[model samples]
Target: TNTPQPKRADRSKVYMADLESALHYSLRVEAARAAALSGAQLDAFKCYVATLVKYFPGRSCVQTYLQSLDTWLRNWTEPELPRSILKEAMKNNRDASHPAVLPTNVTWVGCQGSEPHFRGYPCGLWTVFHLLTVQAAQNGPDKELPLEVLNTMRCYVRHFFGCQECAQHFEAMADESMDRVASREEAVLWLWSHHNEVNARLAGGDTEDPNFPKLQWPPPDMCPQCHKEEWGVHAWDEQAVFTFLKAHFSPTNIYLDYTE
Candidate 1:
């Protein structure tokens, strides 16, 4: 005589089947919703969807699917992406001519600039991996990121870009920028300092001399943020500095009270 199986097992299987069907329907609904988005909103939605597919494949229960979707929506719909070097790079390069073809924010941060400082920036492959890890950390009971994704990012960052000090600094700055700082004033202060440092270096014959430089060979310290190393130093192009600042910072107000 064979023993009878418990009724609960049969019921559990049936419930699972129903859950799968619901999940299929929900995925379709989400796809439709994504289709309706436009501009940056649509782009971001698509990115999230793509990320979900890459990290979590195969069929899932309706409740699990919906929970993951909701969690992703909440985390990504914010004004900023989460903390990651790639995220910072993406934000900086969002206005670049080719945003879609590039890696996510962290890889972008590691790679976007032409400076020698950014030569070892992360590649697209590594970027994908790093992003997968971030997705895992963001997951909770309602959401779960596959451990595989995190491992992928780690492997890519380590293998492709290696570890460097500048890359590390860029990551730190990206983290700081996310907090929005005290105000635009504070942000500008940092931007201005960077500008001054570059200009001062140029004035001291640090950069290659050009016939038609944007600013004078030795630019003047026009803005209050500007500092002079010597009294006899040549005056710099105040206008050029102003233009560069405007392009980068887009200051809303100009305070000239620092002028003589």
Candidate 2:
């Protein structure tokens, strides 16, 4: 008998998929090991965790994972520790088990990473940020909630994101305009515009993946109503984009296709 082929992953929507989560955890371990070798880097990682716990305590699943991660970071300070031992500790200490802590309804959203060096951590990180902002908006009527999430993300990118130049660009953007986000709606749009700006800048640049060119997201195909042509120049209807972003990042739209 012939073996059945696996289903192809849907590429259009950002998925909460396992492949990138695995990459994310692997990178975290690698970063931890590297940070342990350097005092400055280790300080940065510790700050990242502290900020996570401080800003996201309301998010129960994330908080549990952060607690585990904080414990591991504190316990594994010795740079001379063997990699084998470190890996074992991570396994035994429950340090890399975010999925287990996540809510049952929470499904993995896999983003495009058809090949190496394509959209990986950056995509997943943005997805998580977007989700957090949406959740913040939905969790209450506090207008400042979304801004809180955005600022926490700003700090994360500033101190711990692997790409230093990318981090600098994001931090500059936040410093310049994040204050203009006066309401939860503005906060959502702010991140969407920031992502689009990054896409526009990186398009056709060295970081552009040939197979998955960076275009203004929610492209005509995904959300045609969100786009408009004014005086023969393409533009977005802010209202439409706002509506689309909320729904796109909302838990209701999350698919469980590749989730366990």
Candidate 3:
């Protein structure tokens, strides 16, 4: 008998199942525990956080989610941390900058891909950005919504993402089209489209996880309304896809059953 394809409701179920594993890898297994954030890294991370606080359009819960990150970043100071110098670095990009620190001692769950090096951080990172985008949409400013998040991503990718090649590719993609994003929904769609483009391009490539091969997201089986076959090519129903993405990444749907 053929196994039934899961519906939209099942989307969160799948992610939730992976949640514990993803968090463990992102926070513990793969992070560099000892060294504090570098000056450039701080700038990039701050830019990301500030962008979340200053842009995107929505309200209460989402804003609080962003603020929580802000609070955590602010409170992570250690006696060994170069406070004054870090302060100066943050000052340099007052108009455009941020920071990042690697956490340590975490365990793993859904993030252990086909091999030791295949998934982990990459999977968790995707979930992180998607959560922010969806949260912002539900409660961010009406203006600068998309560009804010896009720019934040650009800054972080350029300065902090471990995979230099992937970061460079994202930079090229942003240069080619990120400026086109002009609204809340556009921001979500822009990220989703770019991600799918990457998936299509990497579907059968070397880096793909054998057990998690990249497929066009929210595949036809997962959210049939989001896609359609036309002229022998799959065409996206933009609004439908957008709705699915928002739901899939919604903060409310994110499972909190795992440890941080």
Error of 2 at 223 (Å): 0.6
The TM-score values for the models, in the order shown, are: 0.23, 0.72, 0.70
TM-score, structure 1 vs. true: 0.23
Better of 1 and 2 by lDDT: 2
Model 1 regions lying over 4 Å from their true place: 1-163, 167-183, 195-230, 234-243, 248-260
* Of 1 and 2, the candidate ranking higher by TM-score: 2
Taking the tens digit of each residue's C-alpha lDDT, what string does model 2 give over 1-260?
A: 59877566565454555423633453354344442334555555555555445433233444565666667778776645444554444442234445314322322336545676777667777776776666666664666454777776776676567788998999899999998888777777889889999999999997777877999888898899999999999999999987887787765565556654
lDDT value, residue 87 of candidate 2: 48
| Candidate 1 backbone clash number | 11
Which segments of candidate 3 are over 4 A away from where they belong?
Answer: 1-41, 51-108
Candidate 3 Cα lDDT to native: 0.61
Best by lDDT: 2
Which ten contiguous residues of candidate 2 have the minimum total lDDT? 99-108
- What count of clashes does model 3 give? 19
| Model 1 C-alpha lDDT per residue in residues 34-129, reported as the tens digit of each score | 323344543444444444454432233322433444455555544534324222322212343432221111222222234534322222232223
